[model samples]
Target: MAENTCVRCGAIPPSHDVVSVASADGSFRLLCSRCFNTEMADLAEVHAFEHPEFTPVRLSDADGVVHEFHFRSLLFGDQLSLEAFEPVPGDDDYAGFRFQVLGDPRSDPFELLGNLVQKMKRALAVKHLVEDAGHLVVAETTVRGRIEWDGNERDRLPCVVI
Candidate 1:
């Protein structure tokens, strides 16, 4: 429909889980959680979760490819990052990330981070990367200066696909 609108369902209704997913044509669109998951269902894993900092978010899709999100500091430091690893063939090797954030440094080390909003958006970008293989592309190279990687298939698969 229009720019900044969901391609499948026009105009995002009021909600906080609106996500921007990549279109096959190599662009991005804003989709509500339902629509977003539907659009990406064939390509990756999509789920709702909160950052260790307690910010809520959801994401990924299933395709014959893989997607991952990378976050670089908007300011700089031992910035928090994310990843969804591959399932070891014929093994119960699952996929996941090392998600954590700090607010007061005394917040039990897990509180609403200093930049909650931006970091939440960045973590959301890490959602729904398909557990597949292929060439690597920066799905969202940067989120408010944080980088999101649709990162999968960076290296050759250890086993055959089919």
Candidate 2:
């Protein structure tokens, strides 16, 4: 069989021994272990705000009304900025944003952290969110700045708001 190549970076495929197959829907991807690790590492770095080292902080829309939400996850792709999703008030609906959030004082730090990471990943796959005309077209860190966190560090379990 012929060797495969990376669809994203155009790197030569690795030997079968060091690669893993990731499939989505009807498509299959052959990725070397290194490339796979690299991809994951990049994601981790982009969403590191959810890590234990980062604490969860919240902000309100100037009125000081506390917005209760879980920062589910984040996803980075061909877009220039990072868009985020958070649970809506008194409902399951979620909202996406292009800016970063500081840690929330009233919310549980660990829970918020976990949710933020998960939400980010989920947002990346949301067709409507990704295809929105307001979404950034060129990839750049400035488009979606890194979130700032400040709180007592603690472990937390991951959860998807949706």
Candidate 3:
């Protein structure tokens, strides 16, 4: 594959970006953020949780099961809420299975991220992980969760990013 395009889409995104998805697969792939949020008739899908957002995280088990999770720093208040969702059959838009995690306001962000990544690494352990040009971690990582959306975005990863 070329050094500057998406593995899934086969085209490079414009200056408007998609996050450079990183994974333990040990190779790097450039990810097109726009591809995740393909041009939709609805703009509501664009913001993860309003701008300057908490990272919308994508997690999957090694078997490729994954889910979309969102964190609100609770407006940086005393608590944070993490929400997870699952996909409905034949529909990319999910019906809410609503999994929510509340955090201790004092926990460090990097620490939380590290914990999450380590768990992901373990979930994907020895299965697969790749970091290339167009996508982030294409890990066979335990993407045990599955998320759903409108499916309007054509280039979505096997798992949701955020």
Candidate 4:
């Protein structure tokens, strides 16, 4: 089957029927449906916080899953609140608020990313994790941390990040 690349992470679709949505503004150019939802929602959240006149609303897919979450801008020093509605089986309804003054972007990519993806999955009770490109990893019920650090074999490895 001819492969189609996901615009978000550049990973090819696993199946022919995988749905994808792309934006025309040259921002989110190419994204599979799943990734597109994630990215769009993130952008909406940022925009709502930045622009007060625009009231943000929830966005969902055909199945009515809460795919997008957004909130209106809050005043400085005012408390922000978040509340999630019904969550899917493998998903959780998350609610929280954060306030931070605009600052310069961090230079370290990993620093901006924070802890490794594996650690986050565990915290979220997620069982499946697709690493850079197409490396899929499943976590067992029991936590058995394994770090594959082969210092000498650099040439044979796939560059996970560009």
Candidates' TM-scores? 0.25, 0.25, 0.27, 0.22
Q: Is candidate 1 or candidate 4 better by TM-score?
A: 1
Candidate rank order under lDDT: 3, 2, 1, 4
lDDT of 3 by residue, 81-113 (tens): 333344455543335333544554355545554
Winner on lDDT between 2 and 3 is: 3
Best to worst by TM-score, what's the order?
Answer: 3, 2, 1, 4
- Among the numbered candidates, top lDDT falls to 3
lDDT score of residue 67 within candidate 3:
56
| lDDT per residue as tens, model 1, 1-162 | 444465667865432334666777999768755465444433333233223323223333322233332221110122222222233345332323323343322133232443543454455455233234685333444422223343355953353111
Q: Give the poorly placed runs of model 1, Cα more than 4 Å off.
A: 1-4, 44-162
- Which prediction has the highest TM-score against the true structure? 3
TM-score head-to-head 2 vs 4, winner: 2
Among all windows of 10 consecutive residues in model 3, the one with the lowest summed lDDT is: 39-48
The residue-by-residue lDDT of candidate 4 on 77-114, one tens digit each, is 22221211222344222222111222112123233123
Taking every candidate in turn, the Cα RMSD to the unseen true structure, in Å, is 17.8, 17.9, 16.3, 19.4
lDDT of 3 at 107: 57
